[model samples]
Target: MQGAPGKRIAWLPTLVAKRQDTLRAGHLRFAREAPWSGVLHCFVLDCSGSMLGGQRLALAKGLLIALFDRAGASRAEAALVCFGGAGADLRFGPAVPRWWNERWLRPVGGGGGTPLASGVRQAAQVLELSARRKPAQQRWLWILTDGRSSDQPVRPRHADEVVFVDFERAAIRLGRCRTLADAWGAALFAPDELIA
Candidate 1:
């Protein structure tokens, strides 16, 4: 639809969908289905000091590898944003991670503050960019954190769905992840719950 004109026309669906909008110069827009419409899984990981103390970061890394592997098999794309210390950094791509493995994530260390807001903000940027690049592709945000942060960031509006993977294992739980999930209407799961 972007390049080729007069391509395969989804007539009825297009007409029905576009009925609300006014057409220009009585010219109909032909719509063609993307040859491969895949999903993009954006992960926002917390690499804070609290996560490291309980081996939560280690477990989260393991889970990332698994999820990346799944995305590869499904022919989907993935991105990784890691937050710790004072800021958040994009560690991986918004493209298909064909070369994903433990080696790529083994060096992801944990330290400093949780910086949950920074992590979510960085991920929101990624999701917004992905939405522009692949408007038809579905986007899912996966936030893996220990709920050790005091920051409560706004949820990314571009994400079609969101998931909160809680990694809290402390004797005294904060339950911040659960609160975020409830507020955002996102699916909540513990690391163990996901594994099983």
Candidate 2:
């Protein structure tokens, strides 16, 4: 602590040292880095044909950009799992995005059937791996979809929190997103609700 500049001072350690004897720079303790730094935000996006009908996929992409920006600002780790066209795949990372921009999401095309279960399973694997790597870190699972798929996968056990961002805006609502959120005991919000 004597010459450790730019480090946050541990006030408790400093106070204890002051009470013990005359304050000395050697007795001061600088706070160690945070256990996990920030949360791991794993986003599972649906790139099904249905999402393209009303520009839902585009909206989801916009949200992803905003979220990525926020994650960068918060120094949080992020990962992306895209599901559609028969499978799911990880697109981003478990590491912090040092450089994030909307251009990165531009090439994410959308079409085909929604493989909701596949997406959840893929994201679950990512979350499990992250949990093993950083046990102290909080894990948040975010599913951005239109509730167009019939697949209802079990919630990932490792996720500390879950959020379903429903993009469904059809006249005949499926409400699957709400149901899934309810079943998982997670938060449910519409795309508009999130911005509002």
User: Please, what are the lDDT tens digits per residue for candidate 2 over residues 131-168?
Assistant: 89888887889999999998989999999778889999
- TM values, all candidates: 0.81, 0.81
As a whole number from 0 to 100, the lDDT of residue 20 in candidate 1 is 38
lDDT of 1 by residue, 1-196 (tens): 1235555553322332343366442435454445466678999999989888768899999999988987887678999999999999999999898989999998999899989999999999999998898788878899999888999899999987788889988888889998999899787777775563
The window of 10 residues in a row where model 2 has the poorest summed lDDT is: 11-20
Q: Rate the local accuracy (lDDT) of all candidates.
A: 0.83, 0.84
With a 3 Å backbone cut-off (N, CA, C), the pairs that clash in candidate 1 are none
Question: Global lDDT for candidate 2?
Answer: 0.84
Q: How far is candidate 2 from the true structure (C-alpha RMSD, Å)?
A: 11.3
lDDT winner? 2
User: In candidate 2, residue 189 scores what lDDT?
Assistant: 71
